[model samples]
Target: MGGSGWRKAIRGFNLCVYSPLAAEGGGDVGPPGASYDPPAALSPPDPPALQLPTPTQSSSGLRPRVSASGSGLSKRTCAICLTTMTPGQGHAIFTAECSHSFHFHCITSCVKFGNHVCPVCRAKWKEIPFHVSSDSPRARSRVNPVNMNRRHAHMSFQHPLLHNLEPCIFNDDETLDTTFKTSGVCYNGSINTVEIKTYPEYSAIPESISTDNFTILIHLKAPLGPRNEISSKNVYVDAEDSRTHRAPVDIVTVLDVSGSMSGMKLALLKQAMGFVIQNLGPLDRLSVIAFSSTARRLFPLSRMSEFGRQEAFQAVNSLTTSGGTNITEGLRKGAKVIEERKEKNPVCSIILLSDGQDTYLLSPTLHNGQHTQPDYRSLVPSSIRDRTVHNVPVHVFGFGSDHDSISMHSISETSGGTFSFIEGEGAIQDAFAQCIGGLLSVVVQEMQVRLECLHHNVQLGCIKSGRYASWVTDGRRSGTIDAGDLYADEERDYLVSVNVPPDHHETHLLRVSCVYSDPVTKEVINPAAVELKISRPELVGSQTMSIEVDRQRNRLQAAEAMAEARASAEHGELSEAVRLLEDCRKRIFESEAAKSGDQLCASLDAELKEMQARMVDRQHYEAMGRAYVLSGLSSHLCQRATTRGDSTNSGSFTQTYQTPSMVDMLQRSQTFSPATRQSNSKMRHTLSFPARPKPR
Candidate 1:
């Protein structure tokens, strides 16, 4: 009668008994009338089908729902109701910027009944789209167009918001026309080597742009890692990967043996050329050409074998300076050498070093009190251009203060190459080293990006791709951007301003795809295209934006200021140039990225200050200031970091500043070893040479 007695009785009731025939070792027992027969073994029953976890009923008396996957299993749970959310089951899912997700109804109910914060994370709720019937008879409107414009303008200039809306940026009349002419500026140099990765700034756009337009910034980056500042091993590479192998280079070095490059300059030039030859590998090819009154190929393109390099050194050492400077002839000879390359698909480029202006190629005269700049592009043959000449970049170096910087910069820009100012005797070697470093580290070639608008209502306002050509087709619905060769891990950004209409409601806005060739494999790769989609709601909260987009936009604006300042300085408008630089500095400080302690913004700010100081008056502006400003502007516009110098002494030049180009920072930051690091360091100190200013 105790607990133990009850347990024993329950065990007896649950016990199982075998059949008599089975216990007696007989086969099986059939029906009573049938004879005994062997029985077959019984198989196990099938497992139960998978089912989604059904959420429990809520305290608020809401019915529990089960969210199911393909396997009919629930993966997500709603925090508010303690219920599973069914995706695509007429129940909307709201994802916050913090990446927390909840059922739309649950979150909205919570927000309405509770505080305006996420129930799960307690973070401020964001990006909740709303639909309201505005302009209804019962609805009171309090909208001000003028106030909206002012707010938009503030957001546009203070941060990387809608770039086109800022009047200070475009300085143009507002027009409803959507057609935009692509303004291309060379960010770096042209086509030659590796795989490039591309991605969009944001995954989604807010539905309503009735008050302000949306801007999309797409980034094309080389997968190069951050550089080791103290080491020469700058580019990060997986040795196991074939794509990272240095591409074979075919370079034509054009030197100026003009009368101006006589003593220290000539000696330094020879040394720089020798250094260039030493760095080249057996797979690389080199050629040398010298021009003064005429151009002559001192050395033809030959493999950089030990013996071949010896011959190159001899040719460089035997260089002599005389006669008038003939830059046009030098470039022509260099182009001719490139055309005669023996290597197939090698990284081809031209290095032009000049110390003086071409005596025959004169600067245009002022007409009607306006400075008529000479057409430097017309001075060079079509074959020398990047478009015509197999994308050969012509990297030009101005050796002295008197060297025609405008013409040199133009030639480099037109050819999709970079322009460097080499004033110091020792600086040329350093400049050459940096240039060659970038050349050898190329990984991607002939890169191009295409942006296609998915909706007809969505229009591309403009594409700000530094130095590369971009054009909108299909009546501005689609656009193709030419992104020149990127070095290992070098990133290029394209700020695309899109005009989205209010009536348009689509999930997908644009498609971005890139086509690039790998120099190592000699294979063209077109990766799967990425789509840009944003939900369209009648109204939405301020969405979280990409900091990278903001940073790139800020860079573009700073570069624009540099360009404007350079033009003002060129036309003898010193005060205007200074004003522009000051304005740029103010914007840089006000930028969100800058306030967040972005290093690039700080560098740009310092550069603007330096530029403003350089162009304070006409006397300094004409002396060495014009070339200094041009060099800075060129570096910024081209996105190619260059060492700029001014002659403090007639016998030698001293470097004044170096432009911190994004490409140079990303591509060649680790290029300078301790031995070669002196070049960049010594550039900071101003040396007193008591030199005479070169004639304008």
Candidate 2:
């Protein structure tokens, strides 16, 4: 009330506790002018219920005074409790910006519980007058029956690990539970700021499921909220640039310097490495590994200081093509460099580029002098044979048509990374720039999701979590999903199929919980679990469906179709691949996503059409279409937006790369000079969308 923004000379009063029963009573608590005798000493043992005395007259024998500032107190009633207010008594009137007046205690009690809006007009209050004392009767009385019911449901059983954690509620109901009214529903305001919400495709399933199933879509994201200054740094995140803090990255560039990369390929690789080295700041560390028949470290893991950049330049320039391609060795050596780093940065990854198959694993029996046809199965690299290379992701780049895309795609997918197909002469640098851009903008790391069956009758089914790894545990009653690192504002959708049995009782089906580490604060956050409940109504009622759930289902189905098409094309079944792509496109058009004006559907439709056009013949698919399809599918499965097709076609990666002559001049003139350091250090590309088929 004392702030400069105060517009009225209104009196503020100490909040008084009111009984819910009194408020619920019909307007005849007593006849007009009737007074009830008060009890002797107020006892704190029971809830204090202050009843408003009739405004006919006061005990002091003073009549009420009327003022223009407020409608006379004798004629007014409290909006919340619907009780008369007497003038010159203890009660005071409070007015909001909308000119609606209420009892001081009623409005203050509402605002104290985080309801910053006027109860009558619902206008938001910018500045509240006084602080709420936690030990006040009004504050204690705010806990109504709604919150008590929710507490009973939430505390049914608590795990030792998550005993005191708050429960995440759906909050669509208007009952206004105390906890729901205080904090925004989905946002728990927990240690981790990321918001995780789950929605079942169908709100209510049939009670008698003779042979029926349901797929639930769970979404997780870091909400873009108001900006706050934490520790002398603004931690606010925006939609476009939501990086809370950039974690220092330790990256290894794995180059395949085989005979095939002798010409423009080698030149482009060096240029890409040069751009990467120039772009890194002093906080980031880098290493270089080049491989031919064997692999060796070209540059040790060192910070990107002035001296370190110069050393990296020399190491990149010394690269020469020789012997055969050894992609396995290159990836192994790259992973080793990161694991052997003396000082570990919070974020670490390896960038592997290969233009041919791994000859190290190809051993053809030599009956005569010439070699027989190599076993196709042996061509699959051993790096991904164990289903994962290492904890650090190896973002593999398959250069040109000859690169072993199956192995490259598997390597990146298995290691929780993305696969980029460098088809054009100059796309190597663009791909590397895109990869490095994602590494620099990482916001959350080491994310894990745990989904448990809340009901014994409810059964768990397959969970489609894209490229992230997931496994079922405890006799299929529980499961864990390894989501890995997420960039700023990135959202990953998971479609979990579940089976329900015919039961008379309504109960929760599953509970989802997320655990992640904030890259900036380095704090481990474990948010409360969200439940997916279902009801068995005897007579089915009209139920509203979530469009987002349908859209995610279409996305996964399209990804599966793309995978099937890619496999068909790889096996020389061009006609079948084209048919599959066409079918997927039609399904996308017919899906709810298309009707909802979702951009993802339009993008997928365009990509599927282009893919169908390219799948005309086996020769075309083998030349350029295979890698392109694999890369596109990889982008969709990982839920990470990536640069797809030619850089000219995809306007997202339009930054021009320096030519060979310009690269030489940049290296000689100290490219990352003080003046240019700031520009180079700024992240060029910030991934704004989840993994999709087209560039964002």
Candidate 3:
């Protein structure tokens, strides 16, 4: 108040107190002990709002920002309301320090009477009136984006569209598929990256089913908020088991009985074959073909009855190693036996075991069709691949370094089979055990899986990880993935990214569909759908979660980087390769799906440390590089996308290219030759283990 105004106000107060009419208009001096009441003039009206200067800097030296035009400001937001912030029609003053904007009255009120700091950032500010209730958005909700991701990290695959699920009834004998999915099986059993976490409470498994043919797992991960550049949403999945099946297999063993298969190698081969024989079911059929200078059917295809097995055992015992490897003749004869019985038993297979020592044979071994040389790239006839369950799985085993890996891998991949590089002598049994394990656990055939998202606002693409059989997408949110067979405990994992278009919803629906043919039932199970859920805009908990998933992704990035680096280094772009590996390190750092920075870095460093000019060493390094990349893939997928030696023409560096990520390589590698009539003489060259990979 001004001095004159103050005197007038004081005189007025004096007059009111002394006057008899006041207290009733109290007399101030006379009424010593009496209580006095002030006049109406004593009560002042509301004061004018004192607007303060705009804040230039905060306690932390963060400049406060004001939006004059306020383009992005929404009017609906008000700090005084103490509710969630929404954007729409509002004047706002955003403090750049905290990135929180509030109404003009909103902030001044808190500064004037309440705290001297920003509500969101907790930064100290000069005096201002900001009366905010404690019930306002708490520290957790108002925290920055990174902290948000850490809080809501739990995964959920909500109720799948519950369309047609018959109340599944189960007996005590039925169990969940656990073995193949349990440990580091997805990462060569010795990965130290992402931690595997399963939210069983968030999962829904159909229990009490009378019979379980196969299963489909779904993982729908997304940030709880708008996606940022550093992290992308991903999905991890695995399914099916191997411990439940009575399906009979019609198997033909094609052995490379060349001179190379002498001594202990021959003994191990015999023992491996014997193990398979011993494990055969009564209804299963087996045909043994021993090939050396020529192919001989040791025993024609026959059911494994006691007498039939005894006779087959005798025939196998009488066989002896001899001349050059006529792999074509063996597969040709084996194919005939398998093709005839395919109609009865869909699971027909041809196992080719070779030492690859006959690679230099000038005379090409001939059989059913054409006199083709013993090149490993010889394609198996379509007649053999078709007409059987999925395709006649032409499993090939490469014993000794001399084995034709190119041909062996070709046969296995062409017919969706497996190729095992049996290192060391007498390791044929290990290869055999790997092959037989799958053959025995076979259940459903022609299995195909698809992941379909129903929302139009979001799209998921660049799916990596799972690539065992094949993966085909429909140019949008739906994908058809190959899941060859339902084994006793074998699993397949898929990692896919989410694409957020404008107008994304708070949640999304993910559909996992599996179609397969039950071997025993002889019935086609088409379109078995499983449902999953995705959280909208990951806020906190998810950002730091599932370290194991991150490791898997890191492995993939490192693998791709290694492949590219080797390609560059081989072409004398050593620095380029180094840069690529460095890029891989960054990718590993930013990868939200998998994170194994230390392992990948250490591995690459070790490989570079061993850089010598030895051709064999280089080749091994290149192959190891490819394997390291593949190591990130699901076990089944890595096996399917196994490297086919070196790919580029400029130099020898192994580069693995699956159709999903490397379509050009797929087109180039997939060679098709016209089926010409065979001159009753030729060689169709043929080829897993759950083996632990030794770090290079």
Candidate 4:
């Protein structure tokens, strides 16, 4: 009977307690009413067969106690109420260690009334702490204790639960914790958890979200790209469907007609201009400014609609070559033309083609200070001088060999324009096309980047934007404005090609931020933010991408450097040659680093290295040339001594054959040996006399 009663109690406990708990907690725990007391028959039938206490309704008219166990009556036992246990249905149960149970819902309400212990035994359940199981699901679901503590500290003043209820909530005081989740159990007693939901209040974004005045960002695609086979038919196909506001372009073509540019160079210039004119649409306008001794306008700000092909052809064909190169005057004239047309167009440009030489004016004044006469020739007029002063970009093209490329490059760089060199007449059209294409391709406008510092504790350093980019770094601490240092901040926006990462499909809003200092105020701004939306080009079917000439530009720059170094060496400017060579070396190094393929990079590296080695060899050759000349002079002097029969007259010979100190002898001791010197001496003795009138 005792064993049967024990079996019956165990069965009831398993069914009532373990099953309910396991079902309620998603199969993670056993049922609640698992404990049961032995039956009277099994316990010697003592104490009038003590029965488990039935649940009693409390003052709130709800069942409070449900079950009982040994040594204690069930606090409240209501089978009907207990059977209704379901999640979110208000029915709840809490079992004590003594196997006494009560309604969880009722108990919570009772505890709020300052009840610190179980009502039956007056035992403090709060103080009776239970160890959390390592593999328990509840323990696993709880927020990490350390993270919770950090979050609590992060929001010590504000309520954690309240803060997480909204979106777009900027935390002015929350500190990011870096050391919270290093190790140990996830949920200890120290952590707090904050639950954040999506923000519902931010309903609309303003069309112009920036708080500052309008800013413009012009993205210029790189002027060059890989050389691949492209079909000409696809070149004219429109790849983008969007219509951009095409700004009026004011262009001044400053052509070089110096004596050096006699035939092929001059003809190529004419042909390239023709190509440009043919490609211009009706809405576009053009201007032709030619320069020689003085600048002259062949055509000024004529719309393509009114521009006569015959007149343009006549103007170009009539160009004559004469005199010295005057680049400064040419640039000045181009700038003046654009300045005159600035009101007519927002975009103004100058296209200068030269051999890269500048000649100063010989006369002090002309027409009583109205004009000055140039010494040799002037391609650039004096009127364009103000453009450089005003920071206008000047695009320059160096044509043919014997051109002054260095000054032309300087002009382009100083003016924020591009510098290109045409190796031969054949490349002129291609170079012109690239320049024009770059000028025409403008899609984005009024672009600005705003940065907000998210991390305040870490000290930030100087931030570098992309090459040829600009940034703002000062003014009010939180608001956006125009007044700021150009190079002081990490947040910057400028014109640049958006290079899509591989396998990227959709456009994304990227917030690029970095910490930086304010140059004027010396305040550290953390996590400076520059927001940008990047999208892939909507390429159309069978469209031909325009060929970029950036690679060509780099190669051209490299070649130009080499040429400049040679010229410098020829002019006895060794230091200048070394400087130019070093620049060339650096460019080559960068090119190698930027190349995509190993084979191609290695090939280019080898070529550049060879060129560098050749440059060194050329310098050695120049040195050797000077030595050879000196050696010839020395040999001539020895022959003269033998002719005068002064073999022993070392003193007289020394005075007579004294050479200039400027001459340096070759350091070839082996070749100029004593034996060779003696042989030369004997030969001089045999042939020194003029054959005594041929023994007449």
**In model 1, where do residues sit more than 4 Å from their true spots?**
1-212, 224-244, 342-345, 363-373, 503-506, 535-539, 542-545, 646-696
Top TM-score: which candidate number?
1
Which lDDT value does model 2 have at 87?
Answer: 67
The C-alpha TM-scores of every prediction are 0.62, 0.60, 0.49, 0.38
Minimum summed lDDT over a 10-residue window in model 3 is located at 12-21
- The lDDT of each candidate is 0.56, 0.57, 0.42, 0.35
Error of 4 at 35 (Å): 99
- For model 2, residues 1-696, the per-residue Cα lDDT tens digits are 001100001111111111112322233222244322111100011112211111121354221122334322223554443455656756667877766666565454344323365443346678654654434453334222111223233322111112011123211111112331122212112233667788877776666653236778888875332122111111112234332245667888888888888755665466567667655654578877778898776545766543344445545644556789877677766665655444566777888888898777654567679777644433323443343433577687888888877777877776767777776645656566567756765667789999999878767789888878899888878888988887555678888877777766475789999888866567788877788887777667787567888888777878888889988887788899889988988888988768889877887787787778768887777777877788788788887655456544652232222222222222322221111122223412110111111211
Error of 1 at 152 (Å): 71
lDDT of 3 by residue, 1-696 (tens): 111010001111011000001111222211233222221111111111111111122344321122233222233333222222444534334452445555443343233321245443345555443333433442113211111122233312111111012112211111112222342112111111111112211122222211111122233211111111001101111222112233566788988878777644564465456545544544567778778777665545666533334334434433445688767767776676655442455466888888754434334667788776564444465566564434687777666556655566566766767665554443444345445545644555666666777666445555564435445466666876666664433334556555433222243445666666656566666543555543433232323445444444455555565556656756766556667766666555566442344453344333333332222244554433323322222123443322221222111111221222122212211111000011112311100001122222
Comparing 2 with 4 on lDDT, the higher-scoring candidate is: 2
User: Residues 147-236, candidate 1, lDDT per residue (tens digit)?
Assistant: 122322322111101111212121111111111111111112223323333334554444555322467878666645223211222111
- Look at candidate 2 and tell me the lDDT of residue 312: 55
* Clashing pairs for predicted structure model 2, backbone only: 639-691, 640-691, 641-691
Model 1 TM: 0.62
